[model samples]
Every structure is written in C-alpha cells, then in structure tokens.
Target: AQSVAQPEDQVNVAEGNPLTVKCTYSVSGNPYLFWYVQYPNRGLQFLLKYITGDNLVKGSYGFEAEFNKSQTSFHLKKPSALVSDSALYFCAVRDFWSGGYNKLIFGAGTRLAVHP
Candidate 1:
C-alpha cells in the first residue's frame, strides 16, 4: 500500500514571501508522487508530479518540488507567494503494484493561507 502524509493542517505565509508545504510518503517499491491544488468550491487540479528524472521538478504557477528518495519526501515550494495562492493542497502517492489498476491515495491536505 502507498500513502502520503501532510503533517501540517495549514500553512500561513505573508504575500510576497516564499512558502513551502511539506509532504512525506511510504510505499513499497518505486512511488509515483503528485501534488494538486483546489480553489474555493472547485475540484482539485494537478500541480506537479515526480515520475522519473531530476530530483528537482518544476511545475505550473512557479511551484517546484524536490524529490528525496532517502527521505521519502516531496515538499512543494514557491519562490514567492501571493494572496491568490491561498488554496487547499494535497499530496498523493500511486503504487504501480496495485493490481494493474490506477489508484491514487491522497493525503489529508494542507490549506495554504497567504496573507496580504
């Protein structure tokens, strides 16, 4: 089984300051990690993914995440945050050995609050 943990229930950051949201995972074998964001009353939208490649991966909206295999962590970072960046963020893990079916297990989620 694969699972993700976002220890923080919420992250508070001031506008124009850099922000980071932490995520960790546990799974057997290689893990496919993903990040998604959700706005008010809107469905979750894909933000970034770590399938294979460089340890550092960049995604939409000036967000980036570093994959640490040893730590089993993929923490989301933004150079500078905006008030509009306030949203719900989720970390998900996918296990390929799950009987050939695509199953994504999501974290409890971390709410980002960007105060102006």
Candidate 2:
C-alpha cells in the first residue's frame, strides 16, 4: 500500500534557525508527493509537490523539499524558522489510483513549534 510516515511527533526549534520535518513514503509506482501546512483554525495550505523532475523542489513561504528516491523520503526544509511557521505539517502522497473521487492520504501529522 502507498503511505507516508512522519516519525516525529513534534519538532521544536528556535526562531531564525533552520527547520526540517521528516517524511518517508512507500508506493508501488512513481508517487506524487506533497507538503502542506496548517495553522490554528485554518485549512491546510499547500507548500510544495514533487511530480516528475528535479530532486530539489521549492515551494511557497520560503520552504522547500528534497526528493530522495533511494531513501523513499521527501523531507520539508526551511532555512529560517519563524514563529508564524510554527504549525502542523503533513506529508501526503497521491497514487495512480488516486483519481476522480479518490483523496490524498496523509501522515499522522507533525507539529512544528518555533520558540522566540
């Protein structure tokens, strides 16, 4: 089955420091990977996605992710963390079967806490 795992329950980092949210996925064929951020009382905002080319893909809000095919990993990264960046992060995958009415499967979810 195609799925994603976010090993960390939460990640704490000081403001202005780099931040990373780890994610690993398993899929039968080429996977469509996506990163989304959710703030308090707000819907998830799309950060980025890895579709075909470019191992390194950049996304919204000064965030980016590296697609490691060998490791089957797609980790979200940011050079500097902000208090506003402290939110819930989710790693998701869409398989070939995920079309029409199919939905995106997400990880358990990771909380990012940024300390000022």
Candidate 3:
C-alpha cells in the first residue's frame, strides 16, 4: 500500500527565517507526491507537486520541493518564513486501486508555527 509520513508533529520557526516541512513516501511504480497548506477553518491550498519532469518542482507562495528517488523523500522548502505561513501542512501520495479508482493518501499532518 502507498503511504506518506511526516516525521515531525510540529515545526517551529522564527519569522523571516527559512522553513522546511519534511515528507517521505513509499509507493509502488511511479511516485506522485503533493504538498498542501491549510489555514484554520479553510480548505487545503495546493502548494507544489512532484509528478515528473524535474526533481525540483516549484509551486505557489514561493514554495518548492525536491524529489529524491534515492531517499524516497519530498521535502517542502521555503527560503523565508512568515507569520502568515503558520498553518497545517500535509503531504499526500496518489494511490491507485482496482477499477481505476485513485485517491490521495495523506500524512498525519504537520503544524508549522512561525514566531515573530
């Protein structure tokens, strides 16, 4: 079964500093991983993805991730951290089931707290 893991339950960073939300995945065949951010009482917002093409994939809000096949890791990174960036982060992998039904297998969720 395909699965994702967020090693850290929470990450604390100071505002204006770089932040990283780590994610790792285990899957059969090709790997499709994604990063999303959720604010309080808000839906998950798409951040970046590593479907193919490049090892380093860029996405919204100055965020990016590097796909490392050797390590089986896809860690979300931002050069700078902001108070507004404090939220719940999730890493998901696409899962394919019988009958062509596909779904997302998400991690437990990592809470990012940026302090001023």
Superior by TM-score: candidate 2 or candidate 3? 2
Assess candidate 3 and give its TM-score to the true structure.
0.94
Error of 2 at 56 (Å): 0.6
RMSD of 2: 1.3
* Pairs that clash in candidate 3: none
Count clashing pairs, candidate 1: 0
lDDT of 1: 0.94
Can you write out model 3's per-residue Cα lDDT over 17-99, one digit (the tens) per residue?
A: 99989999999888878998999999999998888898999999899999999999999999999999999999998885523
Candidate 1, 1-116: lDDT as tens digits: 56899999999999999999999999988888999999999999999999899989999999999999999999999999999999999999887677866588899999999999
Off by over 4 Å in 1: none
- Please report how far candidate 3 places residue 23 from its true position, in Å: 0.4
Could you give candidate 2's per-residue lDDT for residues 17-106 as a string of tens digits? 999999999987888999999999999999999989999999999999999999999999999999999999999998658664336889
Question: At residue 86, what lDDT does model 2 achieve?
Answer: 90
On lDDT, who's better, 2 or 3? 2
- Model 2 segments more than 4 A misplaced: 99-102
Q: Per-residue error at 8 for model 2, in Å?
A: 0.4
